[model samples]
Target: MAASLCYMNPTMIVTTSHRSSAELWRQAEEWAQRIGARAVRRQGSLAHLCELHEADGVLTITNDRLVYREPASGLEYFFHPGMAKVRIHNIEVGRGDPMIGAMQLRPGDGLLDCTVGRASDAVVAAYVAGPQGHILGLEKVPVIAQLTIHGLATYEDSSRKVTQLLRRIEVVQADYNDYLPACADDSFDTVYFDPVFHEPVEKSEPMKPLRELADKATVTAGALQQALRVARRSVVIKQRYGTPLWDQLGITQVLSSRSSRIEYGIAEP
Candidate 1:
């Protein structure tokens, strides 16, 4: 399946939580400015705010976390490690992760995540990369990018190791299309792309909200070429099993797990 290019809804309003403090309001205003949205006072519920502002969604900045709410669907998106914690625990127990296997990551290696949605894979990659390695995640969507940046900086885990690894990831608000070309050859050990799956996974309820907010742009051949040029070892693409993207991109080296419907298509630079 091929993905069609789509962007975040422009009609989004940023507001503070109900009973918000002064600092939270200030932060909301700053976020609104950063994302090119209007900052409004929180009067009632998120749904009411959406109706009043005629916005497609409302981004509420609370003391604990940032929440993006779509009134129509009642979908709330926030930053969480999601399955990264489980993947990390699996790694700790000597279980293999398909993504880590595909990337062939090593300590001190540099990784560029071209489509770092919520930084879940990036967090897992960071854990495998260790202290000396670098993980840079590029996200084009404004609200999602900002939310990820904030989450990576603030979200904590029961394990100190996990918390530290999350902090190691660097989230950048830029599209890979513009960010990759300017890079020098062999800029990173690996470049990874996890575009929104063209076919939705029925069991992936957590991804539904993210899919709605993410950039639906599929990885173009030109972009893949740029990634190849930038990566020293290889470029990896993640897609649902049986996706035509593997053949369309001419990637023959594919990795998969018997338990997962996801597959990684790898191409060496």
Candidate 2:
């Protein structure tokens, strides 16, 4: 269970949106009851806002979806239309792009996303692979996994394709370093990793909160070797251009873009 895997904020309050329909508040209270979180009226001086410094965060249920507001971080996290990575994938798809050509995924390919942060890549993979394919995402941090799941479930988009893609992914809370090694040989058509970059860069507001909750586990040589063994075709690693993680893993074949700072390293099995 997620509770056993990682302890979430015990003081996290489930509250309604400041301005929302009455149904939204009812849903929020029911959700709060289900999650064992305190649900209070949206009036002033609620315990959640009162204990601002003492509380870890506030999980606010708006008419659309769940939003996590962290006062200490001064950041709000929720799923919306303007995710940068997903926009990049959409643009590339329009161009018939092959940023990670070696993946060679078809409609029936099975993919394992080692680090499914924001699940942008997983969404793209599922879109290309279609309903017949399998897409499994492993997230070490249970809180982030739960947040992503909620976003996927609650957010309604005008694009039916996007909504379907989001629904296709299966997310699990597990350390990939342990899970990857246990998988049988040739278990998946592609195994991919996009670990947080080792270098420090200016982050956007959304990334700031994510960085706080991300798994700090480094991708080791042994784990890379295991990924290669488990993958039937190729293993891809996404990282910032010229990241030392590539050198550490000795990844030679790379696909890059002069237009952007991100790059993908490919390892064929």
- Model 1, residue 13: distance off in Å is 0.6
User: Model 2 residue 144 lDDT?
Assistant: 67
Task: Give the residue spans of candidate 1 off by over 4 A.
Answer: 1-5
Q: Kindly list the per-residue Cα lDDT of model 2 for residues 10-115, writing each as its tens digit.
A: 3566777678678987877776665456666566533447375356666777665677676666666665434634654655567544543547777889999998
Task: Find the 10 residues in a row with the least total lDDT in model 1.
Answer: 1-10
RMSD of each: 2.0, 4.4
Window of ten residues with lowest summed lDDT in model 2: 1-10
Best TM-score goes to which candidate? 1
Error of 2 at 116 (Å): 1.0
Predicted candidate 1 versus true structure: per-residue lDDT over 95-141, tens digit per residue: 87889999999999999999998999999999999999999999989
Clashes (N, CA, C under 3 Å) per candidate: 0, 0
Candidate 1, residue 32: how far the Cα is off, in Å: 0.7
